[model samples]
Target: MRDSVSKDTLSDVKVQQRERGTLWERVRPGSLLMLVATCVGALLVLSPFLLVVLNAFKSPADYSTRGPLALPANFDLGPLQSYLDIIDFPKALTNSIVISVVVAVVGVLISVLAAYAIGIGRIKMRTGVLAVLLLGTMIPQEALIYPLFYIAQATGTLNTIWSVIIIFIVLQGAFGTYLLAGVLGTFPRELLEAARVDGASRWRILWTVVVPVIRPTLAVLMVFFFIWTWNEFYIPVVLLNSQDAQTIPIALATLRGQYTVDMTVVNAGSFLSLLPTIVFFLIFQKTLSNGVTAGAVK
Candidate 1:
């Protein structure tokens, strides 16, 4: 009886080991395939950016003759300099920076205040207000262009950076309010009550308590707003007719001629235009990630 029991135990162990091995084998292939697919997707998304960077260093002659994808036979800085001269890179970049920064800062401030009122304060008609704000996001810019142009023209803001900045602030503020309202709604009510009980005024409570707690979310919103403002093309093009007020996208478009466009020069300017946004993301990526995860978990 003892010998038979030992043999049965040994058989059971062997069977368990075989099952474990089979499970691992199945999982390994699926995981490998997922990794491969992710890599392929990343490659596809990054290929155009890579092409722009690569072609930026090439000469117009090389770009035209050797194909856009080809490596430059020799490094050439002429196209970059040419692009800078054509676009007046400094003025365009400065205008973009000013417009984007002011929009982001003002937009965030308005959004946080509005979101706090709606989400935390639980004001009357909060739901209706949120719905309207979100509805604004759905309205296509194309539809609003003529109306916006007329408004800018009447206001005498056309052909000025403020025209773009004002529009950006309003549009971005609505989006920020929508995002932050959800995040602020998840705040612990007890904390606010405690602040009030300790004699904190509404403004003090907002600045000292609510702001600190929701800073991550604010960072995320600011980054998004900044990027959107920086990349805004349509409004700037429609409003900023003068060369002095034009931003990077409009300047880049101006590089293209009706008859012919220089691929290398265009690529060079495009790559240069992307640098500020890339730097901004790299700097704020950690905060952005934390904000996203915190919002999700809360």
Candidate 2:
């Protein structure tokens, strides 16, 4: 009994010593270096955005004279107002929201259906289908632009918002198909088998079992789809001619002049353009983290 008590006391002392160590002492030098490197990399990545915020409210004179790094003399709303005047901020904002939401929803629906068929249906030639989807996603938008343009013109969707919306849904669905198909491929079959034994229809099992289990991943895909569609400049610029039809990126791009650009106004427009995606990511951040971790589990 005395020997056992002495061993227990020694173990307790060792644990206490570990707990009492300073955090810096506990963290290895390599881990500390990684932490510092991560912080620096994050700051470097954020520098452009920081510059935009800094200059967004500055006067033209203040920015040009003192340069982009200098602080603004006053929080001038002029640049923001100029952006609003040059482009209809509210109208363009509304168009972008509508297009992005539509694409996210429709894109996810198509992907889920394709993934279901490929991942769970045990379809023949599944490998061929996956290869096709992978190939489709790899094709650059530049290569497809002309064919898409011709189709849009043929269908009378040219210069309208629907053109871009349709383009993204088909394109984005390809990626989501590849991602979710892989996820569903590795999905535990026990739940599916149980559902089948319970006489559940394929559709019923999909909704009741499969969908609920993978919802976090779907949310992440939806958020990505929305942001990707929202940031689109090339497609919208080519397809949307009217100011009222333009999305925020295209609207901001209009601020650039031929020889010289009004950078203060451009920065203000950029901030406005970036705001929605940031807000969206913040809203879905928890789901995104859950999705990433869940994807790693199996």
Candidate 3:
């Protein structure tokens, strides 16, 4: 009986050891390292925005007296209120919304059509056309700034919101086309053939079948374009010299004085400016994720 009990105990111990080893193998050391790396990367990426929010609530005296990374002694809304009042926040916000919306909607529309032509229609010289469009994306915006300025001046579009809106539409539309074309190219040809066999015109098929299938991609592009246009500084600053036509970014820049800068107030404005983009992403994050992964499966 003693020998049998000892043998049973030994077997049980071995079983437990095997289970523990299997669990460790499933998790693996590499997975732990990846998790740690992901956490560190997230912290690094969010640190700047977190600092902006933390400093925004502090008073100028507190911000100056204490370290920038330090927590605010007390929360206050006065600085943000003052910043808004001084900068004419409503006017700038309105201009930004209008420009961003117009650019996003119109640009996406143009892109969808162009993408359909090259990707679905499979027009002649399609490869060459796509190569040219992709090349446009590689060109630095700085290189075109001079030509854009000259063109805007000659056309009497200087200091106008339309100038900024039109420029963004053209640039963003090209990129959107490239992205959407890739997604559309992966679409099953059988679906298009079926639609064609059903006596559906190319336009009808695009609107009915293609649009529904690619709605997620379009949503992603619209959100990106809107956020980009809303936060654009360089083009708006160079083109919109007048205060009345300036967007939120240009308006925010005016918060800094030539002689003296208020770090707290600037932080407040920066935080407020980020609100729209944060809200937008929260609203469309699901669609954006779906769009990004849509083509991966098939």
User: Could you tell me every candidate's TM-score relative to the true structure?
Assistant: 0.88, 0.89, 0.86
How does candidate 3 score on lDDT?
Answer: 0.90
Best by TM-score: 2
Q: Which stretches of candidate 3 lie over 4 Å from their true place?
A: 1-28
Evaluate model 3: give its TM-score.
Answer: 0.86
TM-score of candidate 1 on Cα atoms, chains taken together: 0.88
- TM-score preference between candidates 1 and 3, better one: 1
- Per-residue CA lDDT of model 1 for 1-298, tens digit only, reads 9999999999999999999999887787778999999999999999989999999999888888999889998899988999988888999999999999999999999999999998899999988999999999889999989999999999999999998989989999998898889878888999999999999998999999999988887888888888888988987999999999999899999998999888889899999998888898899889889988976674
Q: Give the alpha carbon lDDT tens digit for every residue of 236-283 in model 2.
A: 898898887988888888889899999999999999988988888888
Which predicted model would earn the best lDDT?
2
Q: How accurate locally, in lDDT, is each candidate?
A: 0.91, 0.92, 0.90
CA lDDT of 173 in candidate 3? 93
Higher lDDT: candidate 1 or 2?
2
Off by over 4 Å in 2: 1-24
Root-mean-square deviation of candidate 3:
4.6
**Model with the higher lDDT, candidate 2 or 3:** 2
